[model samples]
Target chain A: MNNNPYYGPEGHGPYEMIDIGDLLLEDGGTIPNCKLAVATHGALNAAKDNAILVPTWYSGTSKIMEQVYIGAGRALDPAKYFIIVVNQIGSGLSTSPHNTGGAMTGPNFPKVRIGDDVRAQHRLLTENFGLKSLALVVGGSMGAQQTYEWAVRYPDFVKRAAPIAGTAKNTEHDFLFAETLNEAITTDPGFREGRYGSPADVAAGLKRQAKLWTVMGWSTDFFRANRHKALGFESVQAFIDTFMTGYFAPMDPNNLLSMAWKWQRGDVSRNAGGDLAAALGRIKAKTFVMPISHDMFFPPADCEAEQRLIPGSEFRPLASIDGHLGLFGTDPQMLAQLDANLSELLATRVN
Target chain B: MNNNPYYGPEGHGPYEMIDIGDLLLEDGGTIPNCKLAVATHGALNAAKDNAILVPTWYSGTSKIMEQVYIGAGRALDPAKYFIIVVNQIGSGLSTSPHNTGGAMTGPNFPKVRIGDDVRAQHRLLTENFGLKSLALVVGGSMGAQQTYEWAVRYPDFVKRAAPIAGTAKNTEHDFLFAETLNEAITTDPGFREGRYGSPADVAAGLKRQAKLWTVMGWSTDFFRANRHKALGFESVQAFIDTFMTGYFAPMDPNNLLSMAWKWQRGDVSRNAGGDLAAALGRIKAKTFVMPISHDMFFPPADCEAEQRLIPGSEFRPLASIDGHLGLFGTDPQMLAQLDANLSELLATRVN
Candidate 1:
């Protein structure tokens, strides 16, 4: 199998890969030689308790996340606290369907879960960094799932958690959205049952996937008010075409499906014997659930529901008209709000 | 070139056809020998003032509308009023991309608009039915677009209007959803730029379209609550396969695109010099704007925004967790509420 350039470690500057080697997943599947792509900002304090963990979201690499959210005085300040952004499996940089050396590539890639990602991240921090616990763990969307998993599974290891534009338990709406993306990729003629000549061969399916994302990703104001103009685009079609093509054109379809399945099946409740409240109750970390106001997928109501289940957890709505995509710091006002909220949470004393 | 069975008028029960030939459209295109399919119930009063006009929705025939909302003791009863269900252009029953004769069929079909449909319906009621005005004009989705157009374009002709699960002006969210559907059809390999041998050949594209509809057409609760089991389907896929295949498999892709474009372009403000509030001010009818509460496409909030602009209009929320497709009267409770709302609106003494 040829390496797809879109996801390999070629251009991932400031990003480093660590060889964990032969990791067992939550689903009982094992990768022969597991590797994780990660990035770090800031410096670990002498006490080693100043590390923050930031998980990469779906369709995003650590480099992209660092660019969008991290800065000197931002919520994730490089100088204030050490922030480690770990790329999840199925993202080609890590041990994904595309980069696996031997027989486990494409459809042969074993199913991985959010729990598995947290487990690997835990090992990376404990064994590699010698960190006993994280000061805080925060992320948006799929990254949020990992945040919740980290808080719940290793309750003592994460002092605080922030899940933005996502939920601990995947909602029915998100499950279906993930399923639709899977269908778009699989039904493409170039898919050929997960054995394609190149990622570009399934361009039609990727285009369809992009179209679906365009509808679900943004709010009414995003298009009606011509907000794409704010992004320096002349029209909605132009922005969508450029963004979708740029994002999905070079990605391997199988890797996408693998991640999508994991996203759909995300639920911390299963770890607590199918009890959502119980799972939430076990999260001893100081929690903050942040949902975008106009998000069509994860509405404020849904986020608040999850937040209410977590005792003493704060619920803050990210006021933005960009819907689910608002968390990308597209609007400066929202980015400021995000930073303020995160700073406040980080500064909160642990009782 | 080949006759497809789903659209032909072989079994259009109670439905009739009329020729309003050679019509000019709002988009400056003309449909030669333009035809409209219609169905009527109840007798026309001697004064012709008891006529209630119902326009069919996107991808809908008069039969489907009748099945969904029309019956004895239902919201739209033919016995108490002369109910006229007019199938809009672009539906196969009318002068659509599929049914147009000779070279005019398929891709050659002219672009039609909501304004063009309102104009044709005005002519059909005036010339064919000898009706000077309508007691009430009611519809859902695209049919709702026509209802608004009728009220705005010919205020004197419509006394009351009921637009359920829809809005007078399409929102950006709905526009994007419409675009997604159009993309699904055109991207189908069988489309062949609208010159396909048969509708069934593009089964892959149709499946993708069906998947999208499955995601957007219903509420998350509709699936999470296993509502499909109530419809006798053991699984979600079973219901989607049975429903979508049964609905769109036999459809001509061009016919869908024609109606989708019309639905997307629906805007009453264009008549009032692009002023929405001013256009709504022209509505002399007692308007009842009903939007489904959980509808992802046309949320109650969005509907209420438009409803607030109409003079003395009542904004009623259809409290359903079933999202956009709730208007079909799928659940009996919602249907009862719909019937009661319409009954109350019909009984209202118009100021």
Candidate 2:
């Protein structure tokens, strides 16, 4: 994974990292010398109650979130509250297959679950930062999965939660979709059972993977309206050739496979003997279950079904033709609505 | 495709083939020694005007159409009308990559067009059957593309038409989706630039393609409602392993790539200097543009846009949780509705 130039020192911006020692995984394996890649804004105030925890989504790092969602006067203003964006376990910037050493590197990397990432984040807050509870727990996609994990597993610690464009339990349709993503990478004989010498070895597979993402990552209306042009792409093929491939070109294939595995098994329902309603009923936090109207990955209908189960939770749908990727701040109107909602949710006092 | 057991001499029941001789392709290539596989039901009346034509869809042969859509009491009853089911070029039963010999075999197969299939079928009807005009022309998906081409290119020959679950002009979304399918096969190292020794060599690629199809082939509600159980599969994985993989395991990779290329370029608007409305207006046939309500491949809205342009056409949407695969006769209610629609369509008068 380190052989890839995209995630190397020259490609990505610098971020803080702290070794959390040996981290036990949910799948009965251990990630030795596990480290959490971190980025912070503002200060944790004297009361330490103004800290907002944001976790990275699939293939996402802390940097993009800070740039897109956080700003001076925005709901996540640095001057008003301390915000921590922690990269997920398998994300390239964190303790992933590419950066780990010895047996824990590459294909030998152990399977990490959503619960494991939440547990690590909990440790980071309590042990290192001396924080007792979070002002808010929010994320998009897989980060949303982690948001739900935090709310359900440690309900008391979370004051307010917003899981955007994701489901508490991954649907069978999504599980199968992730399977295709995994297969697209592994089927490239260049993959060689995840033991390929470098990222270039699996270029064909990664390209295929990127193409697959284009099929479902955005809404049908997005393509029908030629929305790619707004993104500075002259043609759909140009957008696919430049943007889609460029996005996946930098990541480690094995790290992606690991993240997909965790994404397929995202089920907070496991906390209540596979009862989704019972599990969501445990959330004491003020919750806003946000779903993108055009998101095929986690449709608003699916998100609303779970929201109905969570007591006093609001089902807030962000209308955008960008689909699940609306969370990337693609639509200015959607971003504005998101900021307004967050502001209102934050202002409301939590018990 | 002949090398694969699924379409081998013993595997497939039986079908008739007619040599169309060397056919010039729309792309300026020639399909030397071209032959089309055909299956027929019922007998032509002495008047010879009670004839109907049906073209095969992407990866479909004439046999499945006869089994699923035609029966003694169905709209396509053999006793009432002479039914001709012509397999499209590149489909395994037709002059596909595996079946052809000499330079045209395998990867050397020339690019085919929907117009080419329509032209070949026209020749077969006029030359072999001695027919003046068809009573109706009906098909699903890619077959529907050919159906549209036939109605527009040879407007006088088709008296009535039904293009089900397809659009006259392939949208950018569908074009991009088809690209992913093509890449899935070509990216496999075992594919070896379409020179794989046998089907087994490209098993990984075909499996990936099959998985990609499942992502959009069936609607979200189909999976969410556990519709696969009615198909006799216990779980989604079981359905994918046996049904999805089995569907593509025996086909030639090059053959699929050829068909996908043709499917992506389906555009009847080319007949009218890229004016879609003018091209559709050329259709004199009494037409019913049928789209499956849940079809993600060719959504109802896309179909309706084209349907509105065709003069004296009805926009008919088939309600099914099965999505585009509703054409497979998966839902009994949907099948009954299809039969009813076809019956009404065939009974309509044409000038």
Candidate 3:
């Protein structure tokens, strides 16, 4: 794909960058020479209404998303809809601690909020595409946070919203888990104020982080049932290497920490005078809150609560032992269900 | 408290030790002149059948258990029965990596099993106290593993058994969680292959481990309800520092790793020719299996499954949102229920 080791080749389409310059952050710090890495598929029609926006999740790149979810027969079919996968700020492919220029790179990068991402994406749509509104805004995990933010922050822009395996307001357990991830990185002896060279410097912490993911990202059934074997892994270590450790090893620790902090502090409530109910009330988009049944990070009950607050919002709990990783459609049956749900949402008319 | 950093001084009556020289570990390694640290309260009656055994849990010593659960009006009332709290092999208070001699000290300590603990404890009961049997064998977490092992390995030796907030055999999730804990230490750059000069060398890893515990050891409600404030901490950081990081800071990383390995590999089924049902069927005690409702590590369902297999076992799931830490009776009401349950189990008649 790109020179960045954090990204894999073949999953994402052609990469493009847009510079906004010297973007301000939530914590008063700034990321200079602001750039966003984006990928696109299918041509935008003259009507422009067929454009669908997809945001990437934690440690996820646009290409991986394309590889997993985009296809002719998939819910996110590139043939039917103009698909745009935007990499988040801290993701190494975009303006990140690893790629960004200036003193604010690495640990010095300010804490960016979910709100910032929504705002930046809005600019990209308005200025680059000159699109008035999106047919759909869909995402999973932290990407779900952005989807919810889009619906609430610019409700008129997102006609339909699908947030999977994540919540509008992160649960305390999620916050604590994110904190652990960040701590695992920052506390590594080789972290050295986030100025360390090479991923090997923090290999131990990255391994530890991957191990934690083995427990949280998937349910007990994922291991006991040897689901990794189904994914073509010879053993659990192979699975970890293929997905967990290998995925994170090349990542910049500072960027990971930055993203984790944003994930933990994600609160749409802050926009509605610290009222979560009011925040959900502002969302005009046709919302479908989809949560994986066994997702430890974002339980169905948490997602259900948000869906209940939004008028006409649907609550879909995906019963998958794959847990949070179900966001990737680990089961083809799950992908079918997602296709059906998306088709239903896209076909429905709402004023 | 025998001046051990792993223990508190006020609650435990007195500390003692027993030499079981040249102890053979489950992994076929030996610790020369092995000594087991123990604490005792009340009196061993003339019949020597009035003794209650309590094995220490992970990162816990006898005095700490005394500080938390033992008292005049407590379920673990010293005056009612002779209670012997035996620290596990790798517990710093016992013959651990921190105190063992020669090659067995530090990272060189051999892997020990729940079976090995039961064997050593049996020797202590027979050779020192002249006790033919224990009136009750009760424990929590890793301690619970030993409790279950006691009921199965020497079923006739334990008249009554209560294993709380833990499972007889580690589940896939539990194994992953244990592996994560060990990896947190082993991957620490300061660990220097587990031959670090001081605790500071492993402070970063231990902090990361503590952070993980904060997420998994407690439930979502525990943090959302701000129960840490009930325990006198003002903030989550304060709570994590006081109850988590501080609690683990003094521990030897090698000992923690050894115990974690033992915990992950604990499967009584091996004794029954790899049949879990057969192993549980061997439990002849009047067993009361208590699992915390919200324990992510050891779900109540897993504990229920084990209870169903053991004949004459009473399945009692503790209704608490405190997760695994409820074993220390985090809430007063939870403790009251535990007291009532223990009293009921102790008073019941069995074959």
Q: Flag regions of model 2 displaced more than 4 Å.
A: A1-5, A8-14, B1-5, B8-14
Candidate achieving the largest lDDT: 2
Between candidates 2 and 3, which one is better according to lDDT? 2
TM-score of 2: 0.95
Q: Weakest 10 consecutive residues, lDDT, candidate 1 chain B?
A: B1-10
Query: Model 2: how far is B211 from its true place, Å?
Result: 1.5
Off by over 4 Å in 3: A1-11, A19-24, A29-33, A42-48, A102-110, B1-13, B20-22, B44-48, B71-75
Model 1 Cα displacement at B290 (Å)?
2.2
Backbone clash pairs for candidate 2 read B1-B98
List all candidate RMSDs to the true structure. Answer: 2.7, 2.1, 3.1
Stronger candidate by TM-score (1 vs 2): 2
Lowest-sum lDDT 10-residue window in model 2 chain B: B1-10
Give the per-residue lDDT of model 2 (tens digit) for A1-351: 365666533444557888877888878988876789888999999998999999988888887898899999899999999999999988887889888878778999898999999999998889888999999999999989999999999999999999999989999998988888888888887899999988789888888788788888897889888789998999988888899888887689988988998999999998889999899999988999989988878888789888998888998889898998887788999998899889999998998
lDDT of 3 by residue, B67-99 (tens): 777788787788888999998988876778777
lDDT for each of the candidates?
0.84, 0.88, 0.82
Per-prediction TM-score, please? 0.92, 0.95, 0.91
Candidate 1 C-alpha lDDT tens digits along A23-51:
89888879876899988998999999889
- Candidate 3 chain A: minimum summed lDDT over ten consecutive residues — where? A1-10
| TM-score of the second chain, cand. 1 | 0.97
Candidate 1 CA-lDDT value: 0.84
